[model samples]
Target chain A: MMIKLEQLVPRPLKDRLSARPSDIWNTTLTLEPGNIVKIKAPSGSGKTTLIHIIYKLRQDYDGSVYFDERPLPAIVENELAIVRQTQMAVVFQDLRLFPNLTARENIDLKRILQTPLYDAEKIDEMAERLGVKHILEQQAGICSYGEQQRIAIIRSLIQPFSWLIMDEPFSHLDNNNTRLAASLIAEECKKRGAGLLVTDLDEDSNFDYTHRYQL
Target chain B: MRIQILTTRIDINFERAMRSLNTLLKKLIRTATGRKRFVMAFIGLSVAMLLILSAVQIQVDYNDLLNSKTNQDSIANFLVVNKVLTDRNLGATSLNDSEIADLKRQGFVEAVGLLTPSRFKASIQSASDRFPFFTDIAFESVPNDFIDVVSKDWHWDESSRFVPIIAPNMFLDFYNFQFSFSQNLPQLTQTVVKMIVFKINVYTPNGIMTLNGKVVGFSDRISSLLVPQEFMNWGNSRFANAANAKPSRAILRTKDPGNPTLVSYLKEKGLATDADKTRFSRYRHIVDLVVKIAWVTGLLMFLFAMVIFTLFIQLTIASCKEEIILLVTLGASPGQLRHFLVRQFFPVNVLIVLISMIMITGLQYGAHIWLARQNVYLDTWLGPTTFIAAAAILGLIWAVNRVTIRKYIRLSTN
Candidate 1:
């Protein structure tokens, strides 16, 4: 599956936002399966908002988004839920973790939501690689911010997705942890032959990208 | 291959998950514990109101009154049918031979007897009283078959000049309670009154004769004083002015006093009856009104309970808004959320209804036993109408809960 953004221009933020050049603002982009795309922008430049619109989480944008030539907004809610469950996975900037649930339970919720349920061993292996296994049994709310971010990343990777959308997922992680998390995500994407869209403040050498866009 | 297998299992898993998830949701809500008190209090209040309304809506059995009035030899099957007196026909109220024949022809009437008025002029003089008290007395008689009580001693003997008289039961009550107290005389029992003798004087223009009179029995059926047919016939021949007095009232016996045909027939013929069973019809009307009022009040109480329950649910959802939003974002369908909320509320409603029904039934049974001890018989359970009404109200509560929860979930999801 491919996500095509046609001449996309997001609804501007209410507060301060860095001005986008006309060419970049009006650019059309398509992130296809197996393609790695990076969106770099200054803080508050609607980078998260662009990812949200592609995920159908927000609709306050000027242009249309098509998930494999089907208009994103026209899909019904249940069908969209199905799409989100099996075909798309997102790691939100805020993690969106249920504070009352342990990290393992949070990840298990996403794993059981889709087809070919991920085994517990596989989840623990991924958590071990990202250094979140130690805190996996603790409630997400009581865990450190960096530990919560790793738990959120593990949750997103356990689900089957044709596209993995990350909105500043590694923002709270140090360089060592970021490189480790990036490598695990890359390995999962390569195994599934899925595309990746990672939004951040500046370009990093953690992922070798097929295309780059400024928002 | 994996997606195919998973898709095949989705239906089964979804069903199992819904049940499991609802159980889990109940556990989660139960932990909140803040709203349980309010829910329980409202449930108790609603159940109490329902019990009362259900008890009232039940029909009363008038036969219970018969069972309780065992000492009263009530000839309830007999009705005293009389005609309306009018100025145009001053003697229209008299029961003539034609009217008695017409009454007997009716299918509902089993028997009819014309009342015979006394032919003799008579007055009673009390023998047991310190001061001699004499009062004019009237006598009426029907056939010996119509008399509720019969004894050989009730016969009159012209040779001995002894007459046995049947008096009204109310007359005994009046004398014992009112006259006896006011006159500083002893209140007499039925047995004691039976032992007293009286001087019944039969007077004519030719001569006045004194005869021995004794109280034979008390009649609850007849309000006026009565004498044996033989005595009335003999006295009328000797002292009466040879005028054949037309009977004014007739006693009619029916199979069922509440038979609508009897009432309609009486209405059509402009006849009236002074039977105790007629009052039961009026009593039934009053009971019907009472039941209606109770049902209306119960429905209002149910509405009030619904409001309380709805508020409890609203508070519950509001407290858990964050968790609900998180679940929605995790691809949980609106159906899942609805199932969860419904599970939370439905049990409380079922428990309330069941407890209310059981308590109401038990209360009715207790009341029946209590009344029976006091020689009063009453129906002992919630009637079918009450149960149906309760079931309907319970169903409405469930429906309202579903709709309200669905709406709230939709808003949260959106």
Candidate 2:
């Protein structure tokens, strides 16, 4: 109900090699709910730059991003936070799962913040489907790298979002991990109907052909 | 059609920066050394404030009462007694015969005493109504309205036309008392019920005041003798020697003044009740300063404590900055996060206050026994109820004002 920021715009394609936070921001791309789109870019090649711009963190550069189809020339921090709450979900490269918290607690935060939770069974089923049910009771920090990565995706997947962004979520994984992580993330996105944006994985990477696109 | 694979409640992405203060309070409370350190620090501050403020009050009250510039009357300098030491009906009204014998054997007291207020008729004339008149001239004003608290002076309309309760030093009775009710007169007998009154020798309208108030005391006015104790006793003897039945007033003396150390020695013996102590001789000015300092010091200390507490909360949320960023991405509103944090940190200080206040109060209650004296007790004399209320209210207001979780919310959104 609360509209925070409504516009964001990226600078013209100039120099294209500047390292400032604002220089790399891309234009506002409003994906429909559950619209799964991938922004493919090499590591450190500005894939995250696009995510940062859409999320309202790269305020120093060029171009405008819009919220609700309106122009957001620059999104301030507080408004960005509200935007993040209602319309965004992110899968970070480092698997930002709270190490101290258990898988249940990590999931519980999502439900706890919502009015009446989305559904406890959904979390159980998601964990089971991802083969993380065995380690669901364990501390995320102590979990194996693959397990941590899965749990991070699971936590992000459960949120109600208008946009979902992944920052090289599967870059370091072996071929097996890359495929498993992508398939699992794709399935959850299709179920929720939130826009999906992914980066870092190459053509040979295990990603859905329909959603992949180079930045 | 772009197809999202997983579910999400987030609308937008966000990043938050966390920085906290007062981190050590947590670690401090959890361990024995830390807990003891804080408690000791609290008590030390309390004691410092109490002693310094009280010493100043004693110094001030001394100047006012004595008009003496020397003004630094310590508790030991005066023979103070509780105006109501025997009035509370504390069940210790009359000592058992054995107890009396024990006290008598102590040899320090020439006698033990009691008195009741007796009123019939008396006349007084003042050179000028300009001089203030008090209802009970013996005691000063109570500090709080609706709360009978002791202070330097009562600001009442001394407009009433009654024999203002006999002042210990002022006004002139110019009359002598034949004390019949006294058990012992330093110059006479003890264990007597015969009534008498002390005649006041006032130099008013007149020349010099020569009475040192040795014949009068705390019980002197509250006795059945409306007349001055000295006046009544001497007058009674005169009337009896002269064969007269119409003695104008009654007087009773509980102890003999043969030993000047009677009042101080009795008080030390625990004869005074909490409510009974009406005056302190530590320079009225000094006492005033002491009480004021006690109040002001307490107020400021609590204020400082509150700010520190609030900083602790801000620090806690700051520690969780990254988690905050993640939550925002999960579609949790800024209000929701704040609402949760508010719920989280509010009780931290609340717990501290609850536990600390209880312990402080218990300690004060125990310390009050020492505080129950006419002069310079605890640097200030506060009743248990008043003390508790002050501590609670101070803690509450401080807790409420110092919280700044809203700042964390702003930073996170930023």
Q: Each candidate's lDDT (Cα)? A: 0.76, 0.47
Clashing pairs in 1: none
Docking model 2 quality class: incorrect
Candidate 2 lDDT, B1-414, residue by residue in tens: 123322223221111111111121222112232344445444544443344333333434333334332333322222223323445645334444454455556554433332322221222232335332212212121112211112232222224122112223112221113321342322322111111222223333334222211122212232222333334343234322233232121111222222324445555655542223223323434645666776677557655655554545555556666666655555556665665565554554445445544555455455545644534334223334544553555456444633476676568556
The candidates' interface RMSDs, in order, read: 3.3, 10.2
For model 1, how does the per-residue alpha-carbon lDDT over B36-118 read when each residue is reduced to its tens digit? 75656566556655644464445333333433454233577788777766677675577677777888899988888777888
Looking at model 1, residue A135 earns an lDDT score of 85
**Top candidate by lDDT:** 1
> After superposing candidate 1, which stretches have Cα over 4 Å from the reference?
A13-19, A22-27, A113-116, B1-33, B36-49, B52-83, B89-271, B281-290, B371-387
Segments in model 2 whose C-alpha atoms lie over 4 Å from true places: A1-14, A17-30, A70-83, A172-183, A204-213, B1-282, B307-345, B351-402, B408-414
DockQ of each: 0.20, 0.17
lDDT of 1 at B154: 80
